[model samples]
Target chain A: MDTNTLTGLKSAFQVAPSDELAKVICFALIESGEESEIALYLQQAQKTLDESESLKLAEALYQAELHETARNVLSEELLSHKILVAKCLNESGEPEQARKLYCSAIEADSSLESHALNRTFNVEVKVAQINNDDKPKLKVVEKMDLASVTDMVRYRQDTSDFSDVVGLEHIKKQISKKIIMPFQRPSLFQKFKKKVGGGVILYGPPGCGKTLLARATAGECKASFFNIEISDVLDMYIGESEQKLHTIFEKARSSTPCVLFFDEIEALAGKREHSRNSSSANVVSQFLTELDGFSQNNEGVLVLASTNVPWAVDAAFLRPGRFDRMFFVPPPDKVARKAILEHHIKGRPAESNIDFSSIASKATGYSGADLYNLVEMAADEAIDESIEAGNEVVISNQHFKNAIKEARSTTTEWLTTARNYARYANEGGRYDEVLSFLKKHGK
Target chain B: MQEHKYTMASECFHRGQIDRAIDLLRELLAEEPNSADCHGLLAGCLLEKKRLYAAEYELAIALNLEPQNALFYVLQARINLLRNKTKSALESCDEALQLEPEYLDAHLLKSDVYLVFNKYDEAKACIDIAANLQPGSVTVAHYYGEYFFAKGDIKTAEKYAVDSLSIDPQDEAANILMGKIKLRQGNLKEAEYHATFVIIQNPDSNSALRLFCDIKMRRNIILGGWWRFNAWMASLSNVQSSVVLISGYLVFMLAAQIFEDFEYLTVSSLISFAWIGLVIYSWVGIPMYYKRLRKELERFSFNPEF
Candidate 1:
């Protein structure tokens, strides 16, 4: 069979193309090592081969490290074949083509979306690496145009109220008295010349339910919620970020009884002196103007913001009528920790009497998200046990015991830094709440 | 436009906003992939973040794009030093010096590599050249302080540290050196003040944190003695520590043999037992010290003035 001429083998395969004969012809062609003849054979046989024969031949060729030949044999019309061809192209150092094929395959098949998206990202990285390796080439440089920024300001009509939140009872009460009460009774407040809408800043360690509390505040007040993403307002171009900020403020003002929530507000309102970019200072100024400028009417447009680093925010934003009410959302207490753990473990496969209270007591200093992760870690143990036992294994006290040993509170580091700020940098009693919280926690 | 972005990225890098610098460089590189300065600055930012391999890759591309750039070679030397390839790092520094013989950073980095290898004379030579090149350089003053401190000249080290701090009171490296100098001089309060100042500015500074640990250990006698002993052991390089241990063992063996020759069997056996105990403590002391240090750090309360 190895001694057979390439022309005879090609004719034999063409006369009656079977998987075995196609494999033999591919092997003979590859063994012959005639570059032009092999290229001619592949080009002529690409359209003639059926799907199954092409797939088998391509698989064999791919295993032999003939990537281009395998890619040439596979058809793009079929989704499965396109994926195989994409793999071939990626292996053959044609990542851009492979990315395009994967993208098209994702559009044609929803089930392959995640896998195709991941492959596309990997190939895109490869393309970037290749481009980085190339020598300097003179090309027309295009300026970054910010003519149309993507509006990622998510508007919510109905959201979960404070009832759905896990902990921070004092924060809820403060928000209710200072923020929710105004929206609930605007007419009564109007008689006393008290504005119904003002700014409130929720600041705390991350994963302590600041963003959730902001959402719940809007829900409790029965107002429209505009969850303003940082990307929605931040533009690389100078003045564009300020413009976007104004547009977002206008949109919120037009919708009365609306909660404009900015998560990670420090990114947008950091101290101007700390920022090297002048545009960042301009953005902060724009934010302050939107909050309480003479031309701006923020009546019925409540501004709620949350930041993990409250000390980084500009002092100007903390004045009266602009983020006037600052709430410190500390990590959950003992009782709140138990409730959070129970909430996370509610629908999971778990034993009824798992001694969550005991676990919660052990999980001191855990934030709400930390407790959720603890439950997840416990579930992972249960899953491993189930896989080993070849049956269902409900999460038990033993799993929680194992997880608690491995889990460390991420709040400790944040609190350690906050302690310094609270103790030393507590000018005007801005971090007075943090100081009290630290003392209460025996820091 | 690319130049503007590169300048912005460089400013971010100098401001210690490493992640933001990396992001801006990535965006700029996407538009201007061939910009070697962008790649070199990105590598420096990645080196600050301790992404060694990625830094090396970016630096390699940068050097490939502009083979004659001395700054990229210095960055490559930094990545090599981080990876513990001291010889490769020296070669990179030399390559940079070959391109630009008067490069101050190259001289300073070569000094750093020599200091790592305990080649004090070579380090001092590099520092002297750097000082001559730029007399007002805070970095040169800091390196001089480091060299004198390594040579155990506490008075000279303190003088250089004060000089560096006078040049720039806010310089982190100078302050760290001053803190160490004060620590060695038994001025715990002054040492702690320097450490805390740096910490308040940048909480993630490991050197400042380590200096704080030393000051706190000194203030507390029980943990302080053990912490000091462990810190002494830690200051020795792996080879140096091993040599010390082996020398101690050999001395003990010689003493035991001399005692055995005099028929002092109990004393010789007692000496052997003491040596074993010392070995055991050396093996187990570091982890225990670190555990205690962590607990102490957790319970750290601020001084009223601080």
Candidate 2:
């Protein structure tokens, strides 16, 4: 671990510039506490090392309490490195600089904004602690106020019920029985030892109205709807994501007769083994605890989650008392497709007696969104014809035919992937609904 | 504005962000549904994702809107090739070539379809035309290597594969061709090296997996046979695999009934037992192959020079 040993390790790394050799050299330098040697090694390897290798070396340096060295090793060009450098700066008591770095990284990549904002919050807290003043606390409060001003979640009180949703009568009936009835008659459910609030997961292909169904269910029960986004929970700091999740659950619990709708729930509850980092797994674990932990009462706080890929979700989330009620929101059937087409074309100028059935039959695998696109396409066709003739022309069957030729269903790919999962990985028959739909649709 | 989005979508597609490209194209198509370029680009993205039916539908629309577009015909040929309709694929390629006789992609695709049909002479003619069109193209070199390999000229194939790799070492087709050539030469280690290189970059690549299985079989006959068979099964689409399994079952049942009708009770029982054994082998083969592949990968990691 001395300078000679460091030199020997450097020579070995030079012979084989692999990650393993670089790691060995880093550990050796850290063990010897040779600051000058570590600086020299960083300066030499800066030109030769790739981004991943530099990140590794920076991580090792950070672990050894060499914050400045770690910051020097990381490149400012990469957003990922910027976050790590911000952490190093925060550790070295440069909270303001760290906050600036986080802000810049967030500006560069909006996907990292939530994580950066959480870090900035932590930095404000640190600055307050260091200054021994209440003014920093006021600044923090002002920042929180600003955040609330720009917050996306509105706690909407939608008035639309199942009547607003087109087609899927069977799904609506089931939702009414499993979710709505419990909320409407909680005391009766308690008498029967049935919980009023539990987890229900609605899974289907993209643009198949899972979110719409959740909103309708919330309206049907006359409950407050809280749409939770992934950004609302995930944080860059360790354990902060879990804490944010707990706070969300607590907020829902405080407001009874509330529906917490989480779309793309798989991002939060994906299988632990599939996660690249422990933070994601911890978030999933925290989610499970919030769902059905000891000393937790979720009555009148229904959780509705939807995902396009239910197979990617963790199995533990589907156990009884968690997301036990799994509903598959399939692509609109032929009848449903006709209804959706009619619904989309209601306000548009069109022929009075358009043959909707022929159009619907051609849109076999179209989702509600795809059908909406088809109508838009047909309207475009009509508009083009009107422009050519210098007069407004009503959309006709010919326009529909022209639109059908260009607009293809987007659900077929999802069904194809889902079919594989249902056939091979249908553990506990969780994907039985998907399998049945595929069979009936001849997918 | 739609043209800008189309350009952006094409950039995303080239950068391997296919889902993003598809989203951008869909948005553009929503605004201008009659834009054949957007539909064709979306079809290309779908083809890359292996959503063949959707890709075909989109390409058909693109062709309908612009029947004279040779690019749409080439895209159609690619979809048909993936669907295993070699004749239709050839026809589409010929149509594209007839529209634009010097089109390099159409010539290469025609060569590929001819190679699939084992028409080595036709494949060679197409490859020759392609090479003349793009003499220094890595793709043309790879196609020439494939043509030679299909013709059983291993030395020439190896030379062309080396030539292609020297020009672009990361070319997947060239690496697969080199792996196949190495396999033909009975150089199992080199073949494994080439296949593993491609598989590490793209684990979903069926050709690399097939070559890897072949190399494994050359090393150990029994386990390798199972691995090869499983790889072959996995290469098929869900519907195709199901048909294969059902046809296999029907044949087994037919053989058993014939044995019973001939009063060969022992033969019939043996046939039934053999069928059961084969089914069991197929069932367990997947997990076993994966386990063995993991061990092999671990060994490969430990000895990087290997």
Candidate 3:
């Protein structure tokens, strides 16, 4: 029948032969709000589909919201329905159960060739992304992969550009002798040269030059570097963290003679028991496991982590040989401060009143970050008032004084805690003067 | 009903679950003792199982049951050969040749047995005949490759080995023979990979085991200290591996007491042993290698050309 007959039949109880019959009935039921009648018709259609093994009828019934009937009708002897069930479960947030059904479906029919199964399992997706020898291992997804290792190792080996990281010459030389030289020239200290070292974590307040020192060490070392960010280090799954951890180590192994850098590293390296989120704890477990692999199943690989909150980090990370060395990238001293100030002002115009020697001495309690803030504040103040006369402002003592008055150091609480951690970390005050100054005014 | 072959020897020869199949056939053979196929298969199974005495009587019965069949004489030749009765084996081989000149398996077996008896001319002739009959057969090509390889015709040997592998990738002999060719050519990485592939595909392969172990030993010697550590890590997988490695160490230490090459040899032995353990531990986990071997075996049975 055409549209006219179908329209005419709509007012009475009539059946017609046409491709639009199901569509007409569906629209009528929806328009009349006769849900109960619609449901009955769907159930009957589903039964017929089941009896006849017709996918068309089941699909139509499913569209009609007779889900219960539709589910039964499409439940057997077809891979299409199996895939549909998996889709429904996945959409409903039952992926684990869906994975179970998907695996069973694959097993039930050996010929079930599926790419979705590969994605759901995460096996093939990782394999395709693998950049290793022929068989690119999935282990790079682990917490200790080659990307992070290369970042850390290459960074550790770099001293060319940071050869003049400005002020920490003695400290830089010390790191070079202790860490950099040892890695670069393994035969120099043959007896002490480590194989697949435990690791090291840098702990200090923000801008105390902790990151700079870490980078300086990386730059000086003769290895590849891998800088792993927190976002890339974690995942939103129960076992994904463990898998990622495994992948990380595998990746690291691929690019050996390298370092794995975890900057602001405590994100996943936090104390497991204290980890508030289960996902965070899982990631921590993966990290620790990867660390263990570093020494046991690993060699020539170094794990370098830097953290501001050293106290919040996992206790396991600090045990002997693991982070065997924790250095404090202390805030610059008067001499160091003068050097840093001079380095910043080298190319700038300075007058007779701009006494860096006095400025360095007076800025006794300021950290490196505080000094930068002071500089910025003073520059703005000088420009704001002095340049109103339409002349280029020159930095002077008055500007420094006014800026010092305006800039407040925000590292008090942090300095106090960091000092305590240093005492606990090295106890002997290897950084005695820095610790003493920090303790005097810290929280 | 399919019987599974699983005896240590049978399984090693790729007769998967064929022992159970043999046992089932044995019972069926007892029930229908005169059945031609049953008698023939029982004799073949018995010969494969290395029950030489029983195989002798069984083949005799099969021959009596069907004198005209050439396959029966081939079975008799193989069994006689396994028993070291070279003259009888040669006679059976001759009888088989008379019945069917195109029987490559018989000709191939005769060449191998003749080679064992130091009948080089006869062996070469037989091998050449088998190769001409089935140019695509890896087994025949392998024998020809072996002859040329022994005669120092490295070019001819290499070509034949390549030909054998092209026909059958999972042939342990072909893979191992090519591995040696690559080893002598100083292609250590390629050689090691090929040898390692052989061992991984067939861990219990007695023939390929020495070559595989040799390649691993060579790696440690050439690759240096870090590699020895890597091989050690690989070997720490399980008990069997631990025993072999530890024993290899003890053996190396003993050799060290007597040999000037002790230091290097001992380290090599330790690494090789470690390699075994590593191979054992990692064998199952080294996905695709053995699975591909299994697929290859499946392909052999699945003869799409037929």
Candidate 4:
């Protein structure tokens, strides 16, 4: 593993050499820290590796901790190389390709039956288990029927609670008391004629965990979760979109003790005045009608909608009885940022000395997703070294500092857009939370 | 006897055929619902599909079926990791290690969780245990490269990554690591070459794709917008666009100055306005042109040859 021996091995490998000799020479060059030369030699060696030899070579390199080289050595159409490449792909966050390679692997070898290798499939399998079906059976809706409301709503059992969420203590407490408490103390609320169902809108910068909070709220209340996709409700045909919205509301009512979450709610309920067409206007009207729930009891249904552009939503949706409780999900505070960093770093190997608090303090404008990406960037840096050394390298504080320099907070764009609404269009002091957040951040 | 069916199910799972895999697994489960392996496989598949609640249910069943299994705990830890429950993930990994002291995967995962907490000592301890358990494991070697890369030792990281590639040249993580190391070393061409090669091999390698894009942007800035645009337009054998644009702007400026010299203030102002309009149009139109090109590229229909 010394320099002289490594140089000799490199020379030996350069001459007419056997595969065994080449492997030893390559490994020695790697151990001796001649990376550039080794990479060049390996690239040259790849041309000589046949389909089967390539698989063996890939497997050997994989064992030696050279993941990228393992992936590169494979021929695209070769089935045997797919499994080797797929494993490498999964480790690299290219799960989509990893999945395909795994499938190819299975076709080539009936022995490698472990599904644990592919993360994407595992997610789907979990989905299948949740729905209690072998396949994701889309509910068959009889076209425009009064009794087929449940068909439009997909119910999921969520286990997320306040513990699962990072930071946002104030928002969590507020939501718990106003929304979750009603479900928790239903009989007491009923005695006061206070129905549990009403709408609340969570507006904030994107990637700040609005959807996460909504699910946690439902989980805390132990309510059935129904996530309404806007596309699913918005039909191109006339009256269909409205009918879908109506049906969704009706389904939420029937599936009482339900948290009906409308993600990106602005899309479904944008301002009617700004609409260039009548259909969107009608859809908004239908949404309002459903929120009113004139003929039905919405007692246990909690309508939770989230939007980054709260100012764009129709004014009616913000009125006293509908979406009345507006909570702004701001970017993570210092404590939240530290917690967010911890949350993202979960199960990733890093040096023990990384100062999370320092990173958190420095990352002022970063959202939850921003912090996650920061950790990922740092992890990538460590992974590269780990592969080279043939040993696990630690993610250091310096890696994080470097990553921070490269990573830009996406919140700047959201804040710029929100400032316009808060300053020029603060009708009835609706954007006070946004204005406060902007001020607090020294914007 | 059931290995073939399991393989088929795995194949289905790998092919992005989640529903098909689920169906096959369900059938296998029906035949032997009590089999811990079946439950574990089903749970794994569910986890891949992001059915956390269901995956948890299946995991619980699998764990109940085999209370002593360390793999179950590892899978549970993985699920917890996805859920962002770092403490629980670590605890699960710990439990897995306690059950089977030599469980390298569990150790690796535990190290990862510790790293997330910035408990680097604990993370390294786990990695050390894993290395001892399986000295030549690709997973271990990859983690070694990752650790060094994270520590900002690009030279050492490249060494480890190259070592890994020597073993398996097709290793995606190693390639990405090398691409990153190349970038850090200011070898933009090398980085681009690695990323471009990876993208060709696996279009779904988003990291490689991103790296490739990053290289392009960096190169573009150095190349300058005018030159980059010219280079792109050169495909159409058209240098006329740039020539005309530059000539038109110069002519407008000359005309505005001439009008000012003649004391035709209104005409000069009018000419200035027209000049401004043309500048504005180019500003808007250039971005639109790039956007269209990007959209076409995203379709994966654009040839690399172009």
Scored by TM-score, the top model is 1
Q: Is the docking of candidate 1 incorrect, acceptable, medium or high quality?
A: incorrect
Fnat for candidate 2 (0 to 1): 0.00
Ranking under lDDT, best-scoring first? Answer: 2, 1, 4, 3
**On residues A319-429, what C-alpha lDDT tens digit does candidate 4 reach at each position?**
988888899998888888888887778788777777999998888778899999999999988888789999998889988999999897777557655654565457678
Return the top candidate by lDDT.
2
Candidate 2 local lDDT, A287-351, one digit each (tens): 99999956778988999999998877898999999999999998888788889989989988999
Name the 10 consecutive residues with the lowest summed lDDT in model 2 chain B. Answer: B297-306
Off-target runs (Cα >4 Å) in candidate 3 are A1-162, A168-170, A191-193, A294-297, A419-443, B1-306
Instruction: List the candidates' TM-scores in order.
Output: 0.56, 0.44, 0.37, 0.42
By DockQ, who's the top model here? 1
Q: Arrange candidates by DockQ, descending.
A: 1, 2, 4, 3
Cα deviation at A153, candidate 1, in Å, is: 1.0
In angstroms, the error of model 3 at B131 is 88
List ranges where model 1 is wrong by over 4 Å: A1-150, B1-222, B246-281, B300-306
Winner on DockQ between 3 and 4 is 4
Give the Å shift of residue B87 in candidate 4.
76
Over the stretch B1-306, how does candidate 3's per-residue lDDT look in tens digits?
322322332343345444665776677666667866566776677665556677778778888888988889888888877778888888888898888988888888888787777777888999988878877787988888877766667788889888787555557788788878777677876565456556555555544545554665676755333333433444343664668657766765565555445557666666566656655655454353445433322211101110
Tens-digit lDDT track of model 3 for A144-244: 54554334232334433355565656566667666776677777556665553448777666776766666566666766666667755566645666665
Worst 10 residues of 3 chain B by lDDT: B297-306
DockQ of each: 0.07, 0.02, 0.00, 0.01
Candidate 1's TM-score reads 0.56
Residue A377 error for model 4, in Å? 1.2
**Of the candidates numbered 1 and 4, which has the greater TM-score value?**
1
RMSD of 1: 18.8
